[model samples]
Target: MIGEGVAVRIIPCLDVRGGRVVKGVKFRDHVDMGDILERAAAYRDQGADELVFYDITASPEGRSVDVAWVERVAEAIDIPFTVAGGIRDVARARAVLHAGADKISVNSPALARPDLVAELADAFGSQCVVIGIDSIRENGRYRLRANTGDPDNMTDPDLDTRAWVERVQALGAGEIVLNCMDADGVRSGYDIDQLADVRGICDVPLIASGGAGTPEHFLDVFRRADVDGALAATVFHSGQIEIPDLKRWLGEQGVRTRTGSVAS
Candidate 1:
């Protein structure tokens, strides 16, 4: 169960690729799910606490995020939604915010230029910035990828995940989204140990991403890691688990959550 005071957030991620929402395993083998605007509104109607719109292929394809598409989704959904991908500088971040996105999520660009985190926090307030760290455990240690960018451009420093979290927080990131590459789309459970380690290092809110298949998996993460929020894509898109049902079950388990209006 989550601790006293703060309510746990249930966020649904819409991994957009080429203007369409897609879901994949370990960020590969993606299948088109639906139109971005339609899915965003559906999640909001389903009582999602917040929606995350990730342009999954933006960086790899060397294209800026489709600001026009973002405008369309923002106009369609009443709830807060985050827009990410190819947000390389404050100008791009500003453009997304102007397009009506409530927040901007950054990955590899932040790793390559740590100053961007501080710059964004300084310009738009820390709350508007989310630092996403994607990791995979190997050789008894965790290595990170900023995001799936071109192989030639990606620099795998394989930095320690915990240390990296601390750095980002110090750089003024208001939230951390820890993505476990190994657990991503596997649907087994969240990376509890990994979340705990990152949580211990930073005082900022942590969102555990990847591997959320069952409602029980959420309960486990809340009880064990005490993450501020949980993010999933395939399960929600597949209709295997609905946000309202999950929140209701969580409430029954003594976890405080915002159930929104309750989906009819």
Candidate 2:
């Protein structure tokens, strides 16, 4: 169960490819959404608790996130935000943070070199480091995959999902964002069973990503898995769900969310 009185954060995720916000089913066949800065500012004004910006191609292309946009986003929104993709070392992480991100998320690079997690945590504090895990269920057990679960780049690290969660925490990760590959952009609902398994082992904040289709889905994850936050991309980007309305509805269901004025 989630700690009592812990307010659940509602976050909107922006997956950037070629500097445009994009959404894809199962992390492929992405379609452009809109300009990044416009979307970021809109979500902030909509009362989003936080925002997540992912440069989806950075790792696959062997480059770091463009810090120019990071600086622009920081100047655009008042809410805290996280930047992920291709952040492999302390220097790259520092550049992202210095550009105004409240947190830096590491996925593929951390999988390649696990020590990078401790290195960033040592230099910037654990609270500034977030580990993004892309996972899929295979043979009734969870497995970790690298490269944002892109099929061509998919390589099983041969690490159990639960065990990896424990390892990252030991390495000083302050939070974990678990992206269920099977559930990514499917919109049926969050992977409750997967999330519950992680919550059982994760001591730090756990943000549930992938498979958020409706406001009810958010309610279900918070009520069932006890995650610290629920993150959605397609729903928010496609106007299927709005943050203020979602937060208001969740609060009505007895989920403690940070109160904000709902757009009339």
Candidate 3:
């Protein structure tokens, strides 16, 4: 599934908080990293397949995504970019797309109103709608967690990750980004079992996010799990793993990836 011109993407994430890129451990205690536009351009030049700008505090703050920032980032980078956080309805999604984002991702809002997923897909096409699932493992099962809370304390027993993935896909999500709440920023590795669970059931492009510490972690997930792409912030942001170097390594190991120009 990897070789033979099939490209696995390496996406650099910009977790924006207060209009700046930040990194947090397990979605808490975030520290400012740097300017968003600067980081976006740098990643684009560094050969990132795509850029994902997540307003880390938008949904919690209950506000619309920053269209102006999206416009600026789009202008600075040549690769496809995605904007998520605080996008609740068709109008907001449209605004983000109009601002030059290639896609709009929704997390908490999609859970609150699943219909909005279909609505956005209908208006902007399914390719434009990305369903971001933030999941935490609990009681030996993966549970959905939106906004913020302790993983042990938070658990939606009724809606497991697999069920939600199928539901969102059926609801019109063109892509699924599975973010591991437990592994987020842990730098250990991705939740392989959980990702495999969703991957086995999901047909759309699946992006595995969270716990990317070493390049081997990326290789492991792509090899062990049925994921199309892998996303990481701290590793890329802190210069721990260079995109070109990572791609080269993957290519050397027979893993196909877009090392030049974004794959789209």
Report RMSD for candidate 1.
Answer: 2.4
Runs off by more than 4 Å, candidate 2: 1-4, 262-264
lDDT of 2 by residue, 1-264 (tens): 257667889989898887888877656898889899899888978888999999888998789899998998899778899999989999999999999999999988998999999999999999999999999999999999888635677777888899999999999999999998888868999999999999999999999998999888899999999999999888888888978889889889999988756354
| Cα lDDT of model 3 by residue, 1-264, tens digit | 434766888998888877788877655788888899888888888888898998877886778777888888878778898999899999888889998999999988888888999999999999998999988888998888876523333435357888899999998999999999788878999988889888899999999998999999999999999699999988898898999999989988878877665435
Lowest lDDT sum, 10 consecutive residues, model 1, at: 146-155
- Compared with the true structure, the alpha-carbon lDDT of candidate 2 equals 0.90
Which portions of model 1 miss their true places by more than 4 Å?
Answer: 1-4, 149-155, 260-264
TM-score-superior candidate, 1 or 3: 1
Q: Write the per-residue lDDT of candidate 1 for residues 1-264, one digit (tens) a residue.
A: 434687888999988888898876544678888888788888888889898988878876667798999999888888888887989899999999999999999998898889999999999999999998988897888888765634445557668887788898999999999999788868999999988877788698899998998999999999899899999887898899988899999999988988656444
Error of 2 at 69 (Å): 0.4
Q: State the TM-score for model 1.
A: 0.93
The lDDT leader among the candidates is 2
Candidate 1 achieves a global lDDT of: 0.86
Top TM-score prediction, candidate number: 2
Evaluated at residue 184, the lDDT of candidate 3 is 81
User: Model 2 misses residue 3 by how many Å?
Assistant: 12
